[model samples]
Target: MADVARLAGVSAQTVSRVSNGYAGVNEETRRAVLDAMKELDYRPNSAARALKRGEFRTIGVITFTLATTGNVRTLEAIATAAAREGYAVTLLPVALPTQDEVRGAFSRLEELAVDAVIVIMEVHLLDAVTLTLPPHVQVVVVDSDAGNHYTVVDTDQAGGTRAAVRHLLDLGHETVWHLGGPEDSFAAQRRADAWRAALAEAGRTAPPLVRGDWSAESGYRAGLQLAEAPGCGAVFVANDQMALGLLRALHERGLRVPEDVSVIGFDDIPEASSFLPPLTTVHQDFAEVGRLCVAAVLRKVRQEEPERGTTLVPTRLVLRASTAGPGRRDAE
Candidate 1:
């Protein structure tokens, strides 16, 4: 500190302010201080600072996998939001979706230098385990049914599913088939339930669901089965990746999308627009969901009354070239 202050031609207090990212220092002075610190190879002791402030200024994120688009995007959003608030994020990945894995992760929370934790896995696994954490550490959950016990933030899965189903029905499709996600996924189950309810409400019989593991490959396999089903003119796939695979399978079977079969998907991923004929899909506000998760956890950390119940980020349908009125070939 003394060496940096001397090199930067600033007082020790000014160096301290710059090192701690405290305001009041002009840009030029700050830059000079930074340059001096760089030259001296001086690193701020975050441990000492955390101890002095009685806060770690860090957050822990526990997630099962980053393979899914929603989890990846949500985690990105959380990191961005946390960075803006001058907080660092530490990710703890659980290799599998088991109670033992989840419990193992939570047990380590006591030793982590984080003030709070944001769990991004399904809540059922947590419920199955006798989990314990540091009493002072606050918690926020994403995509879970634990809103009654913790602050929860997630997309409106059911509402989005309903909108997709209704859109297909209004387009003159007599009934819409479904390609659902894995049964264990809460979001997938909510979507499946909404799809069934929407069909029943419209006086249309709901077809048996074909499940996928939220992968393009799984969707391809399911799509092959749907392509052979009689009167399967419209389909609602759970997510866009599976929709991509379904599109391929349909093409292989010479099924023309929106001509013989119309398809709609969820999670309007970046590649949806570039798919052959473009994909009509549901759009989720993943950034908002991530923002809310960070906000909820920070509020809890501050000893503020945590916002109870779930905060649902609404979803909307994006119409594109993938869906249309049933064609002449459909009547065959």
Candidate 2:
């Protein structure tokens, strides 16, 4: 520390301020300190600093998987938000959704050098035993029904599903068929329940649900079944990737989108607008969800009482060419 300070002609405190990214260091002096450190190949001792401060300025993220678009997007947002807040994120990936795997991840929390944790996993996987974490480690959860026990941040999945279903119904479709995601996913379950509720509210019975594994392939399979079924005019797919597969299956079955079977999907991913006919879908604010997760965890870290109950980032319906009135069949 003194060698770089001597080289830069700055005090040890000035070097510390520059290294820690603290304000009040002039640009020229900061640049000189950085140049000296680079020349000397000096690295700040993060562990020593953390020990002195009593906080690591690091966050641990535990998740079962990042296979889905929602998970990947949410994680990306979390990382970005953490970086803006000057905190590092350490991901602890669980091999499975089992309670044992989650427990194993939690057990190693102290060793991970994180002051707080944000868990992004299905709520059901967090049993009573697995929910327990090491003492003094604050937590915030995403996409789980852990609001009653932990600070929760998530998209308004049910509200998004309702908007999609209602949009289809308002287009004169008698009943909207559903292509749901996996049975175990809390987000998927919420969407499915909302779809049903929206249908019942309109005094219409929902068609049998066709479940998918949140994959384009699973959606293709489910699409094949829907294509073969009679009275399958409007469909509400759980996600955009699945909707991509469903669109393919319908096209192959001599069915034209909107003209034959109007479709609406969730998660207005970037590619949604580039689909064959473009996708009219639900847009979730994943970045907001991530920002809230970091904010909530930092609140706990600061000994502040985070607001209990779920913080739902609202979603909106995006209109595109994929959906239309049933009477538009001959227009295609």
Candidate 3:
């Protein structure tokens, strides 16, 4: 520190301030210190600094799978948001949602230098045990009902599902059918429940739900059956990937989109608009969910009172070419 200070013609205090990223240092002096440090190959000890501050400025993200679109997108947003907050991310993937596997992941994170953890608990197995988790680390959860135990950030799944159903009904469809995600996924269950509830609220019969494993292949199989179901006019798919397969199945079965059956999907993925007829869908703000997760965990990281509740980011109904009234030629 003193050597760089001497070379830069600045006080050691000025060098320290520059190294710590403290503001109010004159630009010229900051440049001189940086130049001297570069020339001398001097690097500040991050571990020592973190120890002094009592925080490592890193967050650990634990998830069961990143194969689904929501998980992958949410993870991307978390990394971006963490970087904006001057923090790094460490991903810890658990092979299964079993209690032992989740606990093992947290145990591994405990040995790491992360200040907090964000678990994308898409599986219902984790939701059942969230309230009983050990308090060794501060955690913010995504896609779980852990509001009573930890901060949870999620999309407005019920609200979005209701909106999708209502939209189809308003367009003159007598009833809407659901192509839902796997039963074990928290999001899939929420959407399915909301779909049924929304139908009941409208005094319409809830059609039997076709199940998918959040995969395009499952959707293709489900779509084949739906093609044969009598009076299957409007279909609300859980995610866009599945919708893609469903669209293909409908096409191969010689059913014209909208004119024969209207389709609405969730997630509003980037490719939704490129589908042959596009796709009307619910748009989840995964980026906002990510930002909120980072903020909530950092509050605990800074020794603030931990928050225990769910925060929902709102969803929007995006109109595209896929959904329309029964027997209509296009979306309105």
- Candidate 3 has its poorest 10 consecutive residues by lDDT at 125-134
TM-score of each: 0.88, 0.88, 0.91
Q: Candidate 2 deviates by what RMSD?
A: 3.5
Error of 1 at 25 (Å): 10
lDDT of 3 by residue, 1-332 (tens): 99999999999999999999999998999999999999999999998899898789899999989899999999999999999999999999989877788788988987887899999988664456542455777988899866566788999999999999999999998889999999889899999999999999999999899999988899999999999888898999999889888999999999989789999999999988999898999999999999999999999888885568889999999999887767732221
Residue-wise lDDT of candidate 2 within 1-332, one digit each (tens)?
99999999999999999999999999999999999999999999989999999899889999888889998999999999999999999999888766677667877877877889998976553444455545456888899876576678989998899999999888888889999999888888889999999999999988899999999999999999998877889999999999999999999999999889999999999999999999999999989999999999998998897977889999999999998887433222
In model 1, pairs of residues that clash are none
The local lDDT score (0 to 100) that residue 311 gets in candidate 1 is 89
- Estimate the TM-score for candidate 2: 0.88
Better-scoring candidate (TM-score), 2 or 3: 3
For model 2, what is the error of residue 235's alpha carbon versus the real structure, in angstroms, after optimal superposition?
0.3
Please give the lDDT score for candidate 3: 0.90
**Cα error, candidate 1, residue 38 (Å):** 7.8
Best by TM-score: 3
lDDT of each: 0.89, 0.89, 0.90
lDDT of 1 by residue, 1-332 (tens): 99999999999999999998899999999999999999999999889989899899899999988889989999999999999898999999988766577667777765787888998875353454564333455888899767566678989999999999999989998888999999878788889999999999999999889999999999999999998988889999999999999999999999999898999999999999999979999999988988888888998888886767888999999999999998654564
Q: Candidate 3: which pairs clash?
A: none
Report lDDT (Cα) of residue 283, candidate 2.
99
- Give the per-residue Cα lDDT of candidate 2 at 137: 62
